[model samples]
Target: MYPFEITTPLTIDAAVQALQNEEAQPLAGGQTLIPTLKARLAMPEVLVSLTGIKELQSIAERDGQLCVGAGVTHANLAKQTAQYPALAALAVDIGDPAVRNRGTIGGSLANNDPAACYPAAALASAATIVTNARAIAADDYFLGMFETALDEGEIITEVRFPIPQAAYYAKFTQPASRFALVGVFVARFADAVRVAVTGASEEGVFRWLDAETALSQAFSAQALDGLTVPTEGMMDDIHGTPDYRAHLIAVLTKRAVIAAG
Candidate 1:
């Protein structure tokens, strides 16, 4: 690993100040950042840790939304399984115990790995990314191929997940890394229904418009029947072929709809 100065900033202002330094990078859980640095993929002059910020570690339900702190860990999610069952269920299905213990919701979304699960939930739920600068919509926040709408030196302060009336997340995990090879999150709200597809999209995590439209109307397993997502747009990798993944999108959508019901 490269030599770097580490700053444990207790407030967002301090952390943002540290990030303003040209060579500094904000450190969340260090689950992804540390490995990226150790592999020599990233070399920074400073590490601005968010661990010391007390406000970034809260989780609560308010105004029909679950406002989760940026520092809330997957383990914390699992521990709160009874309250926010869907989110917690998704959390527990993440990586193994160690990784889950160290991974934070903010860290996961900020990294925005193609196979990551949090982004799917955030997208499906139309959650808001509460940052030091502004609140960004889940639809607008995710860019593409490991990118997001966050500005340089900006910090994700919290995330607001809309409380869905019913929801389910389904994924086909890689046996080793436990990363999603193809994952889908489907939710039904009083106003509308939404479906977000991850792991299977070549463009990155995205809303499955067709499936969402179908589910919004019927909200059933058969609502996804005879539906076809273009294979041209889905990810084709060692895990599965493009056609197979396209099919999985439909299959998983049905499963998630059924689970939600």
Candidate 2:
């Protein structure tokens, strides 16, 4: 890693101010950043660590939503199996124990890897992203692969996920990276059904609207029997083809719907 100054800020205000330096970067759990630094992919002049900021590490239920702090670790989230079982279940499958122990939700969302799991959860659950500047809806937050609506020097403070009547996340992950090659998250509400697909699209994580419409009308795996997603926009990597990923989208959606039930 290149030589850089590491600052541990006690408050969000201080962290933002520290990031005002054009060459400074915010360090969350460092799961992804640290490796990039070692490879010389990123060489920031300074690193502002959010670990010391007390307000950014918490989990609570408020006004019928689960408010998760940006700094909350995956391991911590996995333990809350009673309140949000679907999210907790997904958390346990994210990376190995060591990575889960250090990876933060904010870090994962901000990085916005095309195959990452949390974006699907956030979008499917209709979660709101809370940042230092403003709150952004999940629909508007994710722009594309490795892209988001976050501004420079802005920091995510919390994420608020509305409790759903039923929800499930199913992922077909790459064995080595444990990143989803094709993943689906299904959420059922009283009025609507939300379905989000990740690790397949070229533009990144997106909702499967047709399946949502079908499932909303009749909540069952049979509802999606003939539904198909176009393969033109999906990723075609060494591990899977676009056709295969598209097929998995339908397969996983059905599995998720059945699992949700």
Pairs that clash in candidate 1: none
Residues 12-114, candidate 2, lDDT per residue (tens digit)?
A: 9999999999999999999999998999988999999998899999899999899999999999999864678999999999999999999999999998999
Over 4 Å off in model 1, which ranges?
none
lDDT at residue 238 of model 1 (Cα atoms): 77
**Cα misplacement distance, residue 75 of candidate 1 (Å):** 0.6
- Model 2 scores a TM of 0.98
Model 2 alpha-carbon miss at residue 16, Å: 0.9
How far does residue 55 in candidate 2 sit from its true spot (Å)? 0.3
What are the runs in model 2 whose C-alpha is more than 4 Å off? Answer: none
Q: Model 1, range 1-261, lDDT digits (tens) per residue?
A: 668899998988989998999999889989989999999898988999998899899888889889999998899977864655777899999998999888899999998998899999999999999999999999999998789998889989999998889999998887877988889999889989999988987678999998888887888888778889899977777788999988888888888889888
Quote each prediction's TM-score: 0.97, 0.98
- How far residue 129's Cα lies from its native spot in candidate 1, in Å, is 0.4
